[model samples]
Target: MPPVNASREPMTLPRLTEDPVSPLSPGTHTITVRHGLSRIEQRYHVAGTGPVCIAHPGGPGIGWEYLRMPQLERSLTMVYIEPVGTGASGFLADPRAYTVTTYAHFLRAVIEHLALPDVVLLGHSHGGFVAQRYALDQPERVEALVLYDTSPVTGEEFWSAAVANLERFVQRHVDERPEVARYVAALTTRLDQLTDEGATAVLRTIMPAYVCDYWGREEEFGPARRSLRMYAAPTRGDGQPFDVRDELSAVAAPTLVLVGSDDFICGPHWARMIHQGIPEAQLTVLDETGHLAHLERPEEFRSVMTGFLALEREDAH
Candidate 1:
C-alpha cells in the first residue's frame, strides 16, 4: 500500500513532552503533544461516569460520533477519540506515514498523556486494527480490549471475501429492492486518498450493505446516516500489508471479540480468528446484524459489554 497524502514533508513519531494530568471531564478535549519535532494534537471526548473505557472508532476516517454508545456510557466512562488527521486533531506532516504502528504509537502517547495507568480499549472497524497493534505493542497498558467488527489482516484475500459477501448481500436484496444492484455496482469508492465529503459519501452509499437491515429499518437508523460526519485521514499504509495473525498471541490483555454475524467485511470469520488467536478470549456474535452491532441492538450490545466489563473489573482485583 502507498501513502494517500501526497505531501513530501517529513514525518515524525508522536511522543509525550511531559507527564500531564488531564481529568476525564464530560466534554471534548484536545491534547497537543510532541510528534518528533512536530506536534500532533490528540482529540478525545469524555462522557459517562463509571470505569474508563477508551473507545476508538474505525475508518482510520469515520467520525467518532457514530461509535458513541449512550447506553454503555451510563456505566462506563467513554473516551471517544477523533484520531489524528481527522476532525480537529492535528495532521501528520507526512500523511503517507500513517500505519497501524504509527497509530498505536500515537495512541500510547495520548494514553500516557491522559495519565491513566491502563485503559479498557474498545476499537471498531479500522480502530480495531489500531487496538490490536496497540495491545501487542503495549500489552501492559491495556486493561482489556474490545475488538469489534474488525479483522487481523487486510489484503487481497480479506477484500476478496468482502466483495463476495457484498455480492451475496446484493443478490439477497436485488429481487425485492431492484436498486440494490445499482448501489453495489456504484461502489467504486477508493480506499485511499479520500476527502472528508468523499469518505462520507462513500460510507453513505454502502451503508445499505454495511448494515444487514439498514434500508429495511430506515426509520430507526435514518438519522444516523443523515447526520453522519466524516474527516478522511490518510489511509493506514506504510508499504506493507496489515496482518497480525502470529502476533495476536502476544497480546496479554483480556479481549472480547464482538462482531455482527452478517457483517460482510470483518464478519464472523475474522472475529473467530481474533478470538482464537488471543489466549482465553471470549467471542460473541450477534445474529442478523451487520457491521453496526451497537446501533442495531444497543441494549443487547451494552448488556454483553457491561457484563464483560464487570467481570474484568472483578478480576482486576
Candidate 2:
C-alpha cells in the first residue's frame, strides 16, 4: 500500500482542556489532536513551574503510563503524549501513518497547538525514535532532548546484534533458571505467530531479559501490561532496512543519550554511535540497569535528566 500524504488531508490542531479541579492534580490538562482521520489524546501532567518536558513512550504503540516519573514532577511539567494507535488516541486511516516521520509531524502539530514557548523532549525506546525525528525536523522548537534506552537508528544490523545479545544473555540464565528456560522455550511458539494480545503477553514474559534485577525487583517496576491493548500489527513496518545515522548530524538540540548499562537492545554500543553522531551530545550509561532504566532507577534517572536540563537552562540565561 502507498503511504498517505498527510499534507493533503484536513489536519486539525489539538484541543486543550483543563479541568477546574482535576482529581489528579492542579495543572493536569487533556489535549486532543485531530489528525487526518485520527484523534490523538494526550495527558499533560503539569507539576512544577519549571520547563515543560514532553515525553513519548516506547512500543510505537505503548501508552505513556510507564514513562511517568512522579519524582520529576517536582522539577518539570511532564506532558505524556499518547501516540496514535494507542490508548485514548484514535487509529490512522493509513498504515503508512505508522512511520517515524508521520509521528514526528504529529508531535510537531501538538507542540504548535499547545503554543509552547520552549520544551524539552523525553523519549524512551521507540519514543526516542520519534523524539529524534521531531528534533531533527524542528530544531528550534526543542530546548533539549533526553533519549533513554534508544538508538540512533533501527535497521537489520541493529536488530541482528540485539537478538544475538539477548540470546547470549538468556542462555547463561537458562541453565540455572527454570523460569528463564521456560520463557525461552515459549518464544518459538509465541513470537513468530503473535496476535495483538499475544504480542503483549509475549512482551511481558520476555521483559525480564530487558532488566538487570528481574529476579529480585520485577514487581517494583510494575506490571508490563498496558491499560489499553496496543495496535501491534500497524507498528511493524515493511522489512526494508531503516537507518538514521546519516541524518543525526542535522539534530541541533542539546541531546542526552542515556542508556542502561545492561540494555541489550539499545545497549552501550548503540549509545556510543548516537553520541558520536550528534554534535555535543552527552552520553551516560547507568550501571546495572537495563532498557527500562528510568523506571528501574527513578532517582538516578531524575538526577541525570534534571542535571542536563539545568545546564540547558543556564545556557539559555
Q: After superposition, which runs of candidate 1 have C-alpha atoms over 4 Å from their true positions?
A: 1-22, 185-188, 191-194, 236-239
Lowest lDDT sum, 10 consecutive residues, model 1, at 1-10
Task: Report lDDT (Cα) of residue 136, candidate 1.
Answer: 87
Give candidates' CA RMSD values in order.
Answer: 7.1, 7.6
lDDT of 1 by residue, 1-317 (tens): 11011111111212212323455777777788677788878888787888899988786666666777778888998888877877678888886777777778778877886789899999898889999989988888999999999999988888778878878888888898887776554454565666678766666666677776777788766656665566655553464668999999899998999999888888999999999899999999999988887777889999989999889889978
In model 2, the worst 10-residue window by lDDT is: 1-10
Where does candidate 1 clash, by residue pair?
Answer: none
